[model samples]
Target: MIFVNAFLVGGAICVLGQILIDVFKLTPAHVVASFVVLGAVLDSFGIYDQLIQLAGAGATIPITSFGHALLHGAMSEGHEHGYLGIAIGIFKLTSAGITSAILFGFLTALIFKPKG
Candidate 1:
């Protein structure tokens, strides 16, 4: 069930992106940025949490997720660290995703050894 939900929601999101591209003539970068801002705004309104619960990584693995992670991290850190939290909060929030991407890429290269 979880896998089904994730795949369906993720595919829907991709379909939406394709629609935006075809109908609105948006670029890939613009679509990504729009999602990030939209996610941030939705998070601010406390709406994205439910969608995240419903979709899991479908909602949590995109650039929008990055914004959501940063905002959530900043708020939590700001409570404990005060003003400095704003500056470092995003890195703290997104560290897991960033580190995982780097590690996975390194491991993949070591195993595959692809060359141009």
Candidate 2:
């Protein structure tokens, strides 16, 4: 059941992205940014947590989840330490993901050459 929910939710998100790219004629970058903003907005309204509870890793593995994590971390720490905490907490939940992306991207760049 959980697997079913995860698959459905994740697939739905991907389908939406594809629709944006194909039908709406959005660039991939635009779709990515839109999803991130949508996630942040949903989290701000306290809705994304419920989605995560319902969909588990399906909700957490997307680019939108990065926005959710950023907002969630900032808001949590902001309540404790105020302004500075907002800045500090932005990356707290996302540092591992960001670091892994940077590392793997660098390694891939080193291993592969782009055609001009």
Candidate 3:
């Protein structure tokens, strides 16, 4: 059942991205940025938590999940460290993913040249 939920939720998000790209001619980068912002906004309203509970990684593996991490980290840290946590906690929580993304992107670029 968890697998089913994950598959359905993840597939739905991917399909939405595809529609934006194909139907609306949106760039992939724009879609990615929008989803992350949407996730952060939904989390701010306390709505995204329910979806995360229901969908788990299906919710967490998308770009939007980066926003989820940022807000979740900020709120958690804010409790202990006041406003400073809001600025620092997101990096503390998300740096690993951000670092890995940069590292792998550099490696991929080094290996694969873009086509003209």
RMSD of each: 2.7, 1.5, 2.0
Model 1 spans with C-alpha error above 4 angstroms = 100-116
How many clashes (backbone atoms < 3 Å, residues ≥3 apart in a chain or on different chains) does model 2 have? Answer: 0
Candidates' lDDT values, in order?
0.83, 0.93, 0.88
CA displacement after TM-score superposition, residue 25 of candidate 1 (Å):
0.8
Tens digits of per-residue lDDT for model 1, 9-110: 788878888898999999999998988888788888887788789989888866777778778888788888898977768578789888999999999988
- lDDT comparison, 2 vs 3, better candidate: 2
TM-score of each candidate? 0.78, 0.93, 0.85
Quote the lDDT for 62 in model 3: 79
Task: Please give the range of 10 consecutive residues that has the lowest summed lDDT in model 1.
Answer: 85-94
What does candidate 2's lDDT look like per residue over 1-116, in tens digits? Answer: 77888899999999999999999999999999999999999999889999899999889988899899999999889999999889989998999999999999999999999988
Candidates ranked, most accurate by lDDT first: 2, 3, 1
TM-score of 3: 0.85
Task: Identify the runs in model 3 with alpha carbons over 4 angstroms from their true place.
Answer: 110-116
Worst 10 residues of 2 by lDDT: 1-10
Give the best candidate by lDDT. 2
